[model samples]
Target: MSALAPAVPRRTPLDSFAGTWHLTRFMLRRDRVRLTVWTVSLLALYAYFVTALSALYPAAEDRQGRAALMEQPASIFLGGPNYGLDDYTIGAMFANEMTLWMIGLLGVMNMFEVVRNTRAEEESGRAEMVRSGAVGRHAAVAASLLTVVFANVVFALLGSALLITAGGLAVADTFALSTAIAVTGLVFAAVALVTSQLTTHGRGATGLGLAVLGFAVLVRGIGDLQAEPGEHGTWLSWLSPIAWAQQMRAYVDLRWWPLALSVVAILVLLALGAFLASKRDFDGALLTGGSGRAEAPSMLSNPLAMSWRQQRIALFWWFLGTFVMFGATGTYLGEGVEDMVDDIAGSNPEAAKMFGDDPLTGFLAIMILYAALAAAGYAIATTLRAKNEEADGRLDITLAKPVSRGRWFAAHLAVVAFGAFVLTMISGALALWAGALVNGEVELATFLKGGAAFLPAVAVFMALTAALYAWVPKITPVVWALFAFTAITGMFGPLFDLPDAVAGISPIWWVGRYPQEPIEPSHMIGLSVVAAVLLVAAFVGFRRRDITS
Candidate 1:
């Protein structure tokens, strides 16, 4: 006690990280429901697709035949690169089908930080307290990365187990398939991790991540297309991280090194992000936050404008999805339904009328169906804004003002309308652009024509979402559930011999199968009537509701 004690160091790793364990526990608690849902949903999708692939391409010859048929520009863009489709290569089928779509969706979902460290923390001011503790600059970042890594590991293990349990495929193929999907998930996890670091806000993080995700898809698609023509586009695909992860092909021609690339890239990004945090002041960003307006802008003067401002980014994504689907990847991929019609016509030519040869009508119908689905995504997202407002407490204070309940409802409706309108154009436009790009055909009318066809069908999703939000406010996530069911069914249902009753349940089914070009007057009539009825009901029901806990 008499001896002078050595001067204590100003900081230690444990002091700075003491709250990390607590933060990890908190992150787990918040994300359990979300993690469960994401894992289960992915499992269901995995099972359905594995079954579909096993059945549809049972032999090496079948795989080759399918690959040959995938030559259509729409098919190339949407279904992705198929490596000759050998039975051993069934893993590639899953890779081509699920990798980009799942990764992009999951990447965006994980990056939003809607659960832990960002928006939710901001909403509750939990972040301020956590920082006030002995936490270091990198604790939050480390905690968030740890959470995402845990989620990806869980997802991988769960997926591997389900693929094994799902049965039918060869054991080797099953492992390969699961590995490919897991790698895809891991790639997205890395992407989302880096994205969360760069933005000051959750939405911004999501936007940055999705933009990368979208670019990954486009790069892969373009690279694949170029490679087929014996060009350097294959080099382009090689440049993309997604293409690298996918080339592993688990069961066939496995390239293990790409996983290393993802790991290295993710680690480097994490280090950079952590280093930035160490240098910056606490609660600060490497990039400065933009100054908020001194007074509210005139554009945000109304409830509708406020709604639009909040969701404009979401609208942009929906628009992109719609247009891309329409052009070549999405709506155009729907064109693949026509590929089997030759076999169908040979067996029963009558079935070919809607599902028939002469791909023009079938292709158009596919385009419309895609257009509707893309539009629905936007509609559901736009309608969900109401829930977000109330949950965030924005609605409570706004309603306390002179704004009438009806005006408040009406303002959000206006955003839905504008977003929905742009969404329609986007669906048509992206499809047109992709198709034109690959085909080297850029006539203005042709582009306009391609984009124009999807407008009416997409309007239906907006109306349907509005209806759901109106009738049931608390259960807002139901729209996503509905979309999931419809999407899974639309994708693999036909291959599994799904019952008409099951298929009919999706409003997307009523929009008519597209790229088949079966645009019946009755289909348009049905779509319009359904949209009108739902919208009227939503407005009516919303008008009668009161606020709740």
Candidate 2:
């Protein structure tokens, strides 16, 4: 026994990616609409920006502006040290400015969820019925990966085309950037594939995928920031598929080999994931069951308490995230850095004109947006807890008690509404303390001001989520759709020259864009009123409606 080694499984040639194409057509049909939209919307977002940027900033001047900004440490940490900003266009600016933040984040979430939820769900028991008939195990996962890969490639081509049309880049540069971004996604998609095989639960799989995402971001951030200004973050960028795409620098340097690295990473990850997937038994969880406790814990007193008990881990993590993201660590640079960035922005005559004498407001505006968005995130997730409970059949028994439906919905709402407030405060407090600590301001008033100002916009999300949970349960996805819409609109809408009407839909537009200190009380009150109306409608509908599940 002391000398025994673990057993290894034998694999046959048949196990190596056979019969995957059989389900390709079915997968394409099922995901065609979704992929089309996902690819189109992302492309449109970049195209719109590229067009607007082409008009707003001439290529040569844009490059000069980027070069001036690279000298600032704050700028480097936040937006990546500029890629030797020469021959830059609006499209290049859009890519350089956002490559690390928005594009990277959206890419990771979209690809990871597609792999874990669509393909891994099949691997786990959800696909068994379909597999029992005409489907093969390899076919489903292969089809899904194909769909995801195709979607990414489409996005790449669309982005490249838009950049070429708007920015008038050399054809080679446009394709290089687009291909690099797509390759980056492929690498992460492979990472998700490997993660799904190792984890039995979907949540566990998602966690692994996110872990990989976090590593990519961290590696990219460190590489980009620590590198010298105008140096392209070189070898460090090679460590991350994202950094690889970013270093392609599109219209700037247009490096190619980094992308080859991304492709290699993807192939290796896919090979490893396939080998592991072949070894595991279907529907087999990673960890086996544990014996039940001899008796119930004292914490199982009431439904409210039980719900809290079950959700404590989530709450803790949310709180920690709120704390960690207070202004974001990278954005909080030393005074020398902040001063340097301000000088750079000041050096650009256009930015100087845009700032209108006070540029710090730009930073504050971003902070408010980030905090409000985080609060909105908390509100939506908390409200959706009721829907989840109902779906799980817990609500059926809970409603069977002396409890009324309204009371049940109200209890959950109360938890969410209060939790929303708590989350907001936590976010504000974190930002306030972080700012004060770094800058020696020592102002709770600053924190409270930021928290109070964000309320109206954030409150809207809580109300809408509650309304969605109560009345139109069929459209539950709206909670997230609206949440994401708000966030994306606020961030990209301004950059891309979207209609003021559409940008106005973001509560951010109405909240005085805080810490800039406009303090438009009337606008804040108006936003709150809108939120109140939605909440009232939800309450009324829930009071009258019957439970679906």
Candidate 3:
């Protein structure tokens, strides 16, 4: 008689998705406010940019002239693959101005969304508690991915609906363009989930994911530059998720293969992330470095120095990235931009606005703001580190030492300001070096001087954020909102036709257009004074407030 073979029970998809519904609901409830803000902000910005650009180039002839300018190296360096420019419509114009960057914005949104729900929960010990119940190992990950994917889908539908109202655009084209964007978001969200499984800390996961996003965008830009004249596709573009959407040529040919590639990539990344998550223990990382020295070094005695020590790794990475970005922008935007601008400027005077009246001057002006924006991000992240530590209970331990509340708070703010200065200097130097190399007639000193003109604005953001953290610790996340408000006002204020005084509220606006325009010494002095006042307020408020748990 043959022994009866034991049958292994098969698990359905529901088994893997166990507890995902409740988790998804919880995540949606938790993120509803953030989602609303992101959606509203993006929609508003899109409407403004689309409306402004459409008004600027309303006629087909104007659109064609604008499209010709886009073929220039300056345009290629900034915007990827000017599709449908031959018979360009208002919709195509909107896509040309907004698509690549919108993809980047959505990528960032998806990354933070995934990291917050997955690694952040795990790092804070909430994942363990949730998983101890009926939650499957992959439930949280599933819920997070679901929430972000749903958000992406909703945003895409809403954006496409807005695009339809632009007139002269085919409905199919708008749908395709929005689909491409949604797919790009999905791929990066998957990248974040994979990164979350690899790092024990949420910040590490966010950093790694952002690094990948930045590199992908760089590759896409290079590929766009290298694409042969009259060619629509490049092999280099195929390697980047950012370029896949552009490759779809949504408003042009509506190619489907590249989008299929994105979908496949998303599936593979999700599966790999789930596998990694299943193999690791909760709160454990697949990759880790050695622990710090048991005994504190003599140099660690100072609170400011300790803040630097703690933030050094993140600052180093950010500094390196800023250096690369500025250097590349300077090299690409230095010489050839003038010839290209001149060629198109005769046909469309509006080209001057895009390039800021003069090619080299405009490039430098834009690069200055770009560098300041990068520094602002560093400042905000560093400023919020103190609040994050306090939430983790590490602030109490440090305060239990010989440190006073005011001194401890002041040290963090000082470290952020100093770090922002160092990062700004690095970006400025690298930009000057590259610009000098490309524009052989330009002096390095002049370039450096022009780049340094924007640093005071960066400092103002740091001080303002520090003040908010000190007085309203619970609303520290609002710093990002503040940064967004500043960026939109400064960058798009002219396009949006805001009142001069309203635009002047942004510190970057006060910096003046450098190299093209002289530095406003009064503006610089005023910004410094503003920073000082904010710091004094922060010190006072921090001293009086109770430490947040």
Query: Which candidate number maximizes lDDT?
Result: 3
Tens digit of per-residue lDDT, candidate 2, span 465-538: 77876788878776666666777666544444567677776776677555555778888889889899988888
Rank by lDDT, highest first.
3, 2, 1
Candidate 3 overall Cα lDDT vs. reference? 0.79
In candidate 3, where is summed lDDT lowest over 10 consecutive residues? 340-349
CA RMSD per model (angstroms): 4.5, 6.4, 3.8
Ordering by TM-score: 3, 1, 2
Q: Count residue pairs with overlapping backbones in model 1.
A: 24
Error of 2 at 405 (Å): 4.0
Residue runs of model 1 more than 4 Å from their true location after superposition: 1-10, 71-81, 85-89, 113-116, 133-137, 165-184, 228-233, 289-293, 330-360, 429-464, 467-471, 489-503, 514-530
lDDT score of model 1? 0.62
Q: Over the stretch 335-444, how does candidate 3's per-residue lDDT look in tens digits?
A: 55566545544455554565566655765666667777888988987888888898899999999989899888877877788778877766655554665476455557
Please tell me which model should have the higher lDDT, number 1 or number 2.
2
Local distance difference test values of all predictions, in order = 0.62, 0.65, 0.79
**Backbone collision count in every prediction?**
24, 1, 0
Q: C-alpha displacement of 199 in model 3, angstroms? A: 1.8
